[model samples]
Target: GYLGCQDTYYVGNFKGIGKVYSQVFIDSYTRVADAKLYTDKTALTAADMLNDRVLPWYETQGIPILRILTDRGSEYKGNIEHHAFELFLSIEGIEHTTTKAYSPQTNGMCERFNKTMKQEFFDTAMRKKIYTDLDDLQLDLDIWLEHFNNERPHSGKYCYGKTPMQTFKDSKKLAVEKNNEILYLDYISDSQNLTDNQVQNL
Candidate 1:
């Protein structure tokens, strides 16, 4: 059972966009991730990200996304009904779930990835003092994310010694095995950073 998760982070103001945001989406099962630099944060923008980037990628892979978990902020809450984000999920036949209020752990996977990006990618840019413009930042991100999704080892996230894309393919193969239940049990504890409230609900 592969699940998806998303989170947003402030990437600092750039020449073209003040308060630029990094919108990230990742596979809870595979650890494969994607990110986009956005000018602002809103439900419509998040929905657009899914429509334009995430879903299409998954579609091309012929992978079915089971759900997308997000925090309960207004950008994702969408009236708990037919908000833009929820409507998008409905149309895609994907479940829409929110992290428990006051609980960051419920959304730990994406949060952990966000922390990693800040350290490995954003901090590297800052170390080189290269906050020139959005295009430059995006180019840096492109290189970083390519390495992250394709080559980096994933041990903490139930992947013994494999890259994210490798884990994704392995997990899909695991799903068809006779002892499929073990795969679920194996990847269960990747949420150590989640809030207590989130742990309970999740």
Candidate 2:
């Protein structure tokens, strides 16, 4: 999942505002988040974020990312940055896909996570007047990330109202069993077809 702070903020002043850009990438499997503060929304910056922050964190966790889904934002398309991103994904044999234009729902997971981050962290920062600089904001963000991953309860509940992590683990087990059944059926069908072909040859 992905989250980004638009480069505009309405400070308490009626006539004053501040522009800060930030982006985050979350691992759907582990619910871990990696965020960074950026001065611009350029494609170069986006590429750097993917390279310097997102990929490294996933590597550290030994997570094998299969796909990356994102919106059709300018920063993620139609440029050398796109090529760079594709190259990175190619090296890892991961698919990179973009959502349909004007369809935020296609990327709903990231969008919803973004809203939660803003509501839970940014609002608190603004209320407490805590962010004096980008570094300060980043520090607060790190603290909030810990709370989100370790303490916050995700919306969906499983057996006995277990948390997302627990539910996900259970789901993975079921998925493995289902996949094995499918593969076995496919093998059986193929074997029967081969036997029929041999009888026809006779």
Candidate maximizing lDDT = 1
- Residue pairs clashing in model 2 are none
Candidate that scores best on TM-score: 1
In terms of lDDT, model 1 sits at: 0.79
- Tens digits of per-residue lDDT, candidate 1, 39-117, equal 7888877888899889898777656676788998777876646588877788887888889889978988887898899
Residue-by-residue lDDT tens digits, candidate 2, 10-47: 22321122466666665554444566766566666666
- For each candidate, give its TM-score against the true structure: 0.79, 0.65
Model 2, runs deviating above 4 Å = 1-18, 79-84, 157-202
Model 1: how large is the Cα RMSD against the reference? Answer: 10.8
Give the total clashing residue pairs for model 2: 0
